[model samples]
Target: MAGYSARVRGDIGRWQQAGLIDASTADLLRRDVEVNARQSLSFGSILAMMAALLFGAAILIFVAANWEAIPRLARVAALFAVILGGYVGGAVLKTRDHAAIGEALWIVAAAAFGGSIALIGQMYHLSGDEASALVTWGAGTALAAVALRSNPLTVAAVGIADAWLFLKGFDYYSRSDFPHVFVVMAIVLFVLSFWTRSQPARHLIILSLLFYLVLLATDQATLPVAIPLVVASVVLFAAGVLVPERVDRIVRLGGRLPLHALLGFLTGLAVIQFELADEHTYNSGFTLASVVALAGIVAAIVFAGRESRGLRWLAYLGFAFELATIYVVTLQSMLDTAGFFLAAAVLLGILAIVIIRVEKRMKDPATGGATA
Candidate 1:
């Protein structure tokens, strides 16, 4: 049997060498031959998912059964324990073996169980100051993510806590108190990014960026065009000068939420300053600089096309913003209806062309590789 198999393999190898098949086609065939090499689920993952479902259901049943009997403090403690236990168990299992999906499942189960615990607690009482509880839970979840190297559950737990903080902070937004939750979140996510032991770490970092941007936006900072430009400029400069030049880190840390927020805030400011009736008559220096800044941003987009999807999206957004700025400037200043309509037609045509190009790129194998 072995000899016959070797003979067959030798025949195929000879056929490939004799120009009977192209390399790409041959490679595809080889891949097809080994298609089942992919692992669908290991025993560990199956066990973990089952455990997660069971634990989740058990927690639900426990709460439903003891709806009124459980003390408020005890319920809170129970919730915290479930989350903590899930996190600990998941982390321990993952640390022992890194490539198990069960680790992620366990962490998820923990969070689900934790949620039930929280709801149960809520039924009896919410603390006079719930921020402490939120912070503690968020911090614990983050720690578990680190220990277990599970990204999905870590993100899920962090996001839940962040959402709670956002709502809580909004109650005090009038007093200019933005949730400092991002500071903790940033530290936790930064640590996770460095670990990079799991695919979920990237997700956690992305979520962290998102939350940080939300924090920045909701904060009391006067979001004029200058602020975001300053932020981008400063971060880019500092990242260049201070941080070691790791491309992935630089892109994640530099080009993520802050850049997006800066673009959004600046674009918004542009709309506010130029698009309105009375605001159109601004000084020439600022307007020229704004145009230059916007143009620079577009140029950066083109340059960064291969580097970051966020930047590519920003480019589209920046162009739309520029057009909006122009429309407002014209409406407020000249009010030439025919000219405006013509400009709109031209802009739409440009946008259509750009979209077609983008769609083609998306379909292309080159630009739309693994990252895309």
Candidate 2:
């Protein structure tokens, strides 16, 4: 098969030589395999995309440079013309099977939408509220994405929404409570990801939600902040583990929920470690919480590590960091430098053995002991 590796091809060649399969059959198998393999952009497609971006940038810069020279009415007309022309041309190209170029034209159209908003605001001498502009642009782009069913446009919409949220929170509502707008927009993008089946859109939604949570955490005091974060992380991780495939199908995350949950859990643990390790006096309550969190993290590693390589490595890093922090903060004097190194060596050696066993258990038999 065309998609098969060289090793596989070599085996197939051997089989053909041994008269196990005829030439025609081997060719057919290769054709079928190639057809089923994932399609990737050719070098020509990449070049076209690069050219499109440069062309779009040039058009924008040229228009901006001569913007004041053109009449106000003509400026508005030109902006709308570009937007309309881009969409029309893209549709025609798409129908003609020039998909890569058509997609590029659609991106140009989306960019024109933002440019039109800025131009209209300038023409009217409107207030320079970036958040409002971003919200408007994001909404418009989202509408276009829905109409066109374009993933690139959806990505643009997500970017605009994320920017709007960040600016709105920092500049306009720093002292206010959490921005519910972010939650609403994130939910919209989450739905769009499923509708569009776009992994980037889903990842963007995850990032925005995480940013919102971090902002909320930073708004509170240390211990109070740490508790809710830990609880939320635990809940997220639990849901990822317990939620069924049917639910994931409805959600259409492509199995990314568990990865996000793991990240959140690790983040919460890191925050707790920092809080407990920074305190001069080792309070009994803080120590207890730290121990519980650490144990939970280890348990998570043991339970989820085999299935998720990212989680496995992240957990190992977190565990090692926590141990180092604890030793530095509480046991530096009790255990001399040599003793600390000795303890670390022994602990790490045991951990290595355990990890190897787990990896072996999780290895796939069909793949001749290849790891999952």
> lDDT tens string, model 1, 1-372?
334345545546665787787778767665544442332344566576666667677776776688679877786677667666666666666666654544655655555554654575568575634555566556666666665555455655556566665666567423445666566766665566456443344545555554455455445443443356445554653343334256435455543543443454444445334424344365464465457656656555444454456556766777676667666654535657788788788888897788568746645765334223
| Top-scoring candidate (TM-score) | 2
The per-model lDDT (C-alpha) reads 0.56, 0.72
Highest lDDT model number: 2
Clashes of each: 1, 0
Candidate 2 lDDT over 1-372, as tens digits, reads: 133444566666766877889999888766655554424344565576677667777777788999989898888888888889888898799789786788778778777878778878887989866677888889988888788777767877898898887876675634445566788898887787666556678777887877776665666565566667668777767776777475467656656566676667666655666666656474665466557757876777766666677777766666666667666777777887789889889778866886677567656543553222
With a 3 Å backbone cut-off (N, CA, C), the pairs that clash in candidate 2 are none
- For candidate 1, what is the TM-score? 0.60
- What's the lDDT for candidate 2? 0.72
In model 1, what are the clashing residue pairs, if there are any? Answer: 91-148
Off by over 4 Å in 1: 1-66, 69-101, 116-126, 172-176, 196-219, 223-245, 249-278, 306-310, 329-343, 354-372
